[model samples]
Target: MRRAAASVTIVTILLLLTGCWDRLPLRDLQMIDVIGIDQDEKEQGVTVDLIVTSLKGAGKGQGEPIAERTTLKGPSVIEAVGKTEYMDQGPFLAVNTRAFLMSESFASDKPVEEFKFLLHAPYTSINTPVIVYAGKMVELVNNKSSNRQAPIEKLHNFIKSLNSNGVINNISMHEFISSADEPLEDYPLPVVRYHESKFQIEGAMLFHSGRYAGKQITNEQLRMLMFMLGVDQGRQRITGSVSDSKSGLQDITYGFSVKNVRRSVHTQKGTDRLPMVTIRVRLNINVFDIGDNIDTLKPNYAVVMEKLLGKQFEQEAAGMIRTAQQANCDVLGIGKHIKAFHPKLWKSLDWRKDYPNITIAPKFDIQILNTDGFEQFQ
Candidate 1:
């Protein structure tokens, strides 16, 4: 009797259950693969470009392509999205969207804080990779690859490569928010440019206090910066001459690749007068090429590599400090260091006011772990 009563109750609950209230059928919806945001030259407002992908059935004798695209634009992102509603299709869904490309002009003029509202919207995904382009968004979305993968997938894979290789700082929505909120930290966004047949990562956009600070760093300098911050993953080729132990007058040329980098930051308290900041870096390397053989190279290789690396590291550190000082931007988290070590002093002095004058000391130690082919020469 109890089982019969429970079955009746379960059937009643099942009868009340229905499909999602806001769900739209896939067949009746226009699927958007890419969204572009830029400044509208004619309207003095933002322009939203939607790239819609549709599929048509193949005829009996023909094999049709799987996807087709159509574009729609409007003064606002939402309006541009709504323009597709009049189509025979029921609605447009961007939840499956893979990429969002913003023009440099739009990103510079519109602070990211203004766009945070979109995070609350139902369709946008937080993990959707965002790319800032110096050129038009249309050009980016229309890019075709010789490879068979969809354009969106190709672009997403490229971004993943850049992040894993540490070529540029990967600035996501969460990181952007944290940097913007912190008083001491600044944000850097990867910059992209379209040149001829290919797209290239130009460098990074440096931001200070929620505004576009007028400072940009090149890819080479960015790599060096990442090395100092202990994020080095990309390949580096170094060429230099080292002195032979037996023959002081003879110089041997050598080249190597950096396999890994580890770094840490230290701060010395400021008495009522001065404060000091020190950065220490350790590098692991592999020798790939040698121009000449030095029998004594094995023992002295560490010393020579350390000196060369120390000089290179110092140059990069000084350049970063100068770049931020000139723009009055603090992207390195120097303020956080001060706050962590000397809270009382950090509270008394404003970092922004004193950052331009602060002194920095950088030290580096390079270790050669394995020589890929130097064993033959030895």
Candidate 2:
């Protein structure tokens, strides 16, 4: 009799169980892949744009995903997102947002301020990657993928290739928050531009105290910057063409593929007791796309190539350091290094004012590994 009563109670419990009470069915939702925010100065408010992807088929078979776009305007970011409820197909699902962009004017002035909604919104993912769009917001939003693929998919692939591409670095939500919290380290974000109707990463956007001040570095310039940071190392270490004052862009000449780089930072006190930073860059390279009238296999030719490439790399690397310093951007985290290892030196001088005048000596030691001598047989 007890067993029968227990069985009856178990059946009653099982009958009362229900699944996914609050779950929203996928078919009823629209997925947003990209979110772009811009300032409407005329309206004195923020304008938000989103790219929503919708599948045409209703479970019969999969149909090609189509992009449905919507724009919302309000006095603030949160209000702008709230205004989306009145748009067709209802509000978008933030779960699919792959990339987020903000206008230069918005990000340059106060980036952390713009991220307030994401922080307070309990459901938003903290890992979502954010980028600053450097061009006109309208021009960027008007862009449809040139290759016929969705812009969201292209951006996703582009970010995945960042480490290998070497030209730029990605700034995710986590990176932004970390950099914002660190007072010494400046923020580094990938700058995007709509060029030739396609999205291209221009370079890194440097921000000091949340102000951009309209400064940017080019891709070639960023390569040297990353080299000195010693973070990229073997990946994306190839520098194309040595430029000359008279002619320009020596792509016909030898191109270098850098590998196995080692970097060290040293400091010394000058006569004025100011700190001096010396950067030593060591790398092995392969010579490819050899120019005409030059033989790489010859011992003398090899020496000349090494000297020429090393000197060129040194000059460019030094220029990159200066560029960063002139803008008062410490992308190298040199100040942090000084604080940790040379605390007295770091505290003695105002780094912001002295950074531009600091003596930064960059030395490049390059070794050529392959001469491509057997190319004729291959």
Candidate 2 lDDT tens digits, 68-167: 6778888887777876557565543442466788887888767676665576563355577778887777775577642227455766676667645655
My TM-score estimates for the predictions, one after another, are 0.78, 0.81
C-alpha RMSD of each candidate structure in angstroms? 5.2, 4.7
Clashes of 2: 0
Model 1 misplaced stretches (Cα beyond 4 Å): 8-21, 24-31, 53-92, 145-151, 174-180, 232-255, 270-274, 290-297, 371-378
Alpha-carbon local distance difference test for all models: 0.65, 0.69
**Candidate 2 residue pairs in clash (backbone atoms < 3 Å):** none
Candidate 2 structure lDDT? 0.69
Residue 108's lDDT in candidate 1 = 84
Candidate 1's TM-score reads: 0.78
Number of backbone-clashing residue pairs for each candidate, in the order shown: 0, 0
